[model samples]
Target: MIRGVRGAITIQENSEKEIIQATDRLLHKMIDENQIMPEYVASVFISVTDDITDAFPAKVLRSLEGWSYVPVMCMKEISVSNALEKCIRVMMHVNTAKSQQEINHVYLEDAVVLRPDLASK
Candidate 1:
């Protein structure tokens, strides 16, 4: 079976260093929480708020030790009237046996406000 693991984090600024670091942190957390391996990942979809333009979050994932081959794409999040800023969101598709309820979605830093319920799960 295939499953989608979701995660989101907010960066302090729009610098490339901040984007890469936050994305790297969030990805690792998601992987650790779900016990995911790069080989089992089908693809990763990342979206960043419009304020984040310094870099693409995919760069961090692709540079991981065994994640060079994992498919990754990055996009800009839709602009809402009063939405969160400097946020990065990821949806990773993976081949796994876990059921939907067993999956642990991750939300970190300021992004936690975006999904308070999942943040504690």
Candidate 2:
């Protein structure tokens, strides 16, 4: 079955390299920790806080992971009051044997506060 997996991270800086590296780390960890196969991923949608415009997080993921065939898109996150800053979030849809409850969602750095329960899991 194809299901969505959520993951997020906060960039320490606004630099392109920092944003890209942070996204790469967060996504890789999410997939590895969940035992997700890269080939099974259908597509990915990434949203970044307004502070992050140096580069698109989805593009960086494809570049770093050699996921050239995976479809990816970028969007801006809703700037809610007191929201985490410099954050990049991902929703990856993939085919997996695990059910939704068994899927792992990663929340790294300052973004971990967004979903304390999932982070603890």
Candidate 3:
């Protein structure tokens, strides 16, 4: 079966370092929480708010030891009024046995406001 894992996190700044750190944190959490193995990941699609132009989140993923073979892409998010800033969102397609309801969606930092229903306790 195939499942999608969603996650979002807010970065403190637009610097490449900050983007990389935030993306790393969010991806790690999502992988850990979902018990996902790198080989099981089909692909990853990531988007960042327009304000974040310093880095591509997908580039950071390449630095991961076992993620080099995983297909990944990053794009700019549609800018909307009242939307969260410095936010990065990711959707990962994985081959997993779990059902949709069994997947965990992660929302961290100020991005938590974007999905109160899925916010971790």
On TM-score, the leading prediction is 1
Q: Work out the TM-score per prediction.
A: 0.96, 0.93, 0.95
Predicted candidate 1 versus true structure: per-residue lDDT over 24-105, tens digit per residue: 9999999999999999999999999999999989999988899999999999899999899999999999999999989999
Q: Provide the overall lDDT of each model, using Cα atoms, as 2-decimal numbers.
A: 0.94, 0.88, 0.92
lDDT of 3 by residue, 31-56 (tens): 99999989999999999999999888
Question: What tens digits encode model 2's per-residue C-alpha lDDT throughout 60-82?
Answer: 77775658888889999998998
Q: Is candidate 1 or candidate 2 better by TM-score?
A: 1
Which stretches in model 1 have alpha-carbon errors above 4 Å? none
From the highest lDDT down, the ranking of the candidates is 1, 3, 2
Worst lDDT run of 10 residues, candidate 2, spans 57-66
Candidate maximizing lDDT: 1
Model 2 scores a C-alpha lDDT of 0.88
lDDT of 1: 0.94
